[model samples]
Target: MNWIHSSKRFFNNFQREILAFIHRKNLGKLSPLYDDSKWEPGHWYAEHYQRHFAPLRLKKLKILEIGVGGYDDPKAGGRSLRMWKKYFRNSLIYGIDLVKKKALEENRIKIFQGSQTDESFLRDVLAETGGLDIIIEDGSSSNEAHIKTFKTLFPALNEGGIYAAENIHHSYWPSLSGERWSSLAKGSIFLENWIGCGGSLDLNDPKTLMNMYKRLVDGLNYQDFLRPGYSPSYFDKHIVSIHFYPNLVILYKGNNDKPSNFIENNALRPFVLEKLGVESLEELGLEFSLDNSTPECTHLELSKR
Candidate 1:
């Protein structure tokens, strides 16, 4: 058994070295997705990131990626950091891993030793880097760590920046579901249901981060609802958009301070009332009458008849 493990390690290291050599030679000429020879292994995100990061390619940017690989091997991590350095060119890449990867630090890439779940450690990293333009959470797939990291670092993202969490399918697996506490449940699961049902969950239970997010998603169309005592969420005011992809969630942070308002266009009211077999707007609790003077008056008159 010991010999088998040793042989496996030897072959893996040999392959890694060969790939690293090929990657170093090609460097900026090839896309990270196309070049499997590169040490970084996120072929799935390459195309997506290329499209999203096109604008920031040449610009000086700060990026933080949680979870450097190599696990127990101190010398084996920082593949993604190196990839980012090559791909972004001018961008500074910062990576944090649970294990020490200080040996992997180079000109534009820095590796910090820390756990993604530690709020204070994350804050320290942010302090050292000042502000971040991109935050990628690829750390421990444990739901608690994912939730804690997002809650801690998302607000710190620069306005108009992006926060992306990968490998979110772990929410469904029993090992990573964080079943011990509801708040620690996979965010992807929460988001799936929240978006599908349009915030039908209880809002009072702050223990579940999903509930909080549900409220924020609700805030997008808050004016349409009748929750009298509910206050607006910071995310509601700042999150420009939430995008969900397979095993991924991207949050776009921006100025979303615009108040949610209803347009007074009643163009569809006549058709809707006719379909419902309703006579007066009073049935719908609306004061305004759909008379002939209304824009859809012909339809309204026809419906009344």
Candidate 2:
């Protein structure tokens, strides 16, 4: 866009062949949601990945992508990590994987080879990147890796920063799922994975009396932040909350508490917000394409807390 307005569009389109390859390998692993037309994450949750991260205008910040594999391979979606550099100009985008490969090497993409379970390796990366504004863990598809990384980095998260773990459904898979420890982390509070404690907000069941209190956890109260009607951020008054069908979501962590639902605010401290980066996404505008004509992939419950 710096050169010409014409440059604005998805820079890549060779995703179809890569999609075909992933499907053949998974062999209908996505049959549950695939309607003989669209594809699911196969080995990787593709649509959900875009839903969760692609939209945010992360400029002038540091982003760490753990387990970023071959973007050309179906799992990595034959994509380029340099796009992250595009999204964040003053940003230092780093990618770490078990093995260092080609897709791992892209514009401004710092590569690190190590296990997420290794504390020294993680610290070394964080130390090199200086600090992170966002951390996306899409590695090995292991729950242990997710948990271990979270324990190590969540506290390191820059105030109102974002820490995202893709394919979290692995947390439920018996073997790789590991064990559900406590709600405590090294520095951050472990939020019950959206499905955790008090998460069963079934429409069939009546709203609990306690959740209707005046002082919501994160803010003054639901009524205080209301503009008049619209249900006030829908029970849980998160900044940008979207629960797309089965599993996909995009939520901001404000100063709230653990297991906070509709009324309860889990934001214990203030959020960081983004800095004035050289590459501000403000020009990018809002990227969530909700147009009806654009078919949205239904979210699948891959992992639950």
Candidate 3:
């Protein structure tokens, strides 16, 4: 048994070296590198990744990818880690899985065994990595896990870092995604039966990772929200951009403090009314009272008429 394990280890290392040699000259696109490492195919995710990753290819980075490829079998995964290491030549690639994969670790590549939803374990990993420049959540394919892991890890990511959620299409699959659709009208047979028939693609499902990310989009414009005393959530203040792809969602983190031209201190500025050729708030169809001391419309009250 010991000899068998040794043979497997020897063959795996040998195969890695051979593949490395074969693809040593071709380092143009990440898709080819994925193929070289026998990870997910190029057609699946290469284009989107290339668009985002190509710019950071040369920078030294710390990247963490949730859900290393193999299941239960400690020796079966790490394909994508190798691919990432090759693509980001100056990066430290870290992967986490439910099963221990210590055998897969190599220079510039580290593996941790833990559940994605375990906050403590994630924090420990973050401490070891110091901080993350990029995080790719490809674990479990469960929307619940995706959302949980994201909320826990995204805040730990460095400013201007990239956070990506893969397999988000699973949000539509009731069985695999663990997202529950709201119950339809019990009184209406047609509406109740039609709900979740083929699979729920409910954009309103707040539980799904997709909708959660979609909601974060509004955060990018937190400066423009007209609500009084509205405090931007951590996500709103830090999430600078959100990009949605087929089964992927990528978030860019940065300061989101850009003020809206029309608003000041959360109130609509008086100049906006002048630009609209309105002498008063009434002329603009906004039933709002101008502060007796200031020209700015501090309180808005819509006319019933």
Candidate 4:
């Protein structure tokens, strides 16, 4: 039994080593474009990036990618940084890793060593980069780490820029947090709550990033519920759109300051008048009156008030 167990362990280790070697070797050949060609063995982010970033490729943008692996081996990581540098020829690429990766530094590609959850470190990096046009959160999968990184960096995205969080499926697994249903890391829960899924929320929990998003969404529509003593949300005028994918969430930043307007028509007024026994248009406070003088000449016109 001991020999059998040892053999199994050895086989697993060997397989891991072989796969790592192949990945390292193929990393150099993959291109963000050219979907028909064979892709290097890695996360299938190239196609998504190609679609979203095609417009900004030629712009001189500042991009930050969190989590450069290969922990202690400084010479081993920064594969994504290199890929970004090649893809965005005119852009500067910045990468952050928990371990020191000074060896990966090169022209147009800078590597910073720090934790994704460290707000101060993240701020310093932002200062060094002079603000960011794009941010990709590919760091630790812990719920706290994801939330911290997002809260710290998302606000820093430039107007008309994007923030993408990848590998978000970790939120649904117990190994990353707790139970799938109760876990705060679940991306689905965040999206649901943001879209106004009715439920009570624990606002104090660190895993409650969804609550933040929900509040922002409410802020966007605050004009509808404006009343006495109402406080405004900071993101109410900043967030343009929130997009969700299988294991990803991308946020676009833009001016969302336009107020929503409601255009009421007479299509539904007839139903109310016929079914509820309404006497006159004044009961409904409707400015438009329905005219049925003739079937061919019937029309609804606004009243001069």
Q: Which structure among the candidates has the greatest TM-score?
A: 3
Preferred candidate (lDDT higher): 2 or 3: 3
Worst 10 residues of 2 by lDDT: 292-301
Clashing pairs in 4: none
Error of 3 at 235 (Å): 1.4
Off by over 4 Å in 4: 1-43, 175-229, 262-305
Against the reference, the lDDT scores of all candidates come to 0.62, 0.43, 0.70, 0.61
Model 2 regions lying over 4 Å from their true place: 1-58, 71-80, 176-254, 257-305
Encode model 2's per-residue lDDT on 1-305: one tens digit a residue. 56554344223223433453354223233222222211344333444544555445445677787755442242342133444554355677777766555444656767777877777777676666664667766655444445456546644555456755555344333331224533332222123222232311332221221121112232324332212222333223332322222322223445432332322222221221123332433333534322211111111122111
Candidate number of the best lDDT? 3
How many clashes does the backbone of model 4 have?
0
Give the poorly placed runs of model 1, Cα more than 4 Å off. Answer: 1-43, 176-216, 223-225, 263-305
Candidates in order, TM-scores: namely 0.63, 0.44, 0.74, 0.61
80-157: candidate 1 lDDT, tens digit per residue: 777777667788999988778899899999988987777677667776887688998877755556666776777777
Estimate candidate 3's alpha-carbon lDDT, on a 0 to 1 scale.
Answer: 0.70
TM-score of 2: 0.44
Give each prediction's root-mean-square deviation over alpha carbons. Answer: 13.9, 18.7, 11.2, 15.3
Clashing pairs in 1: none
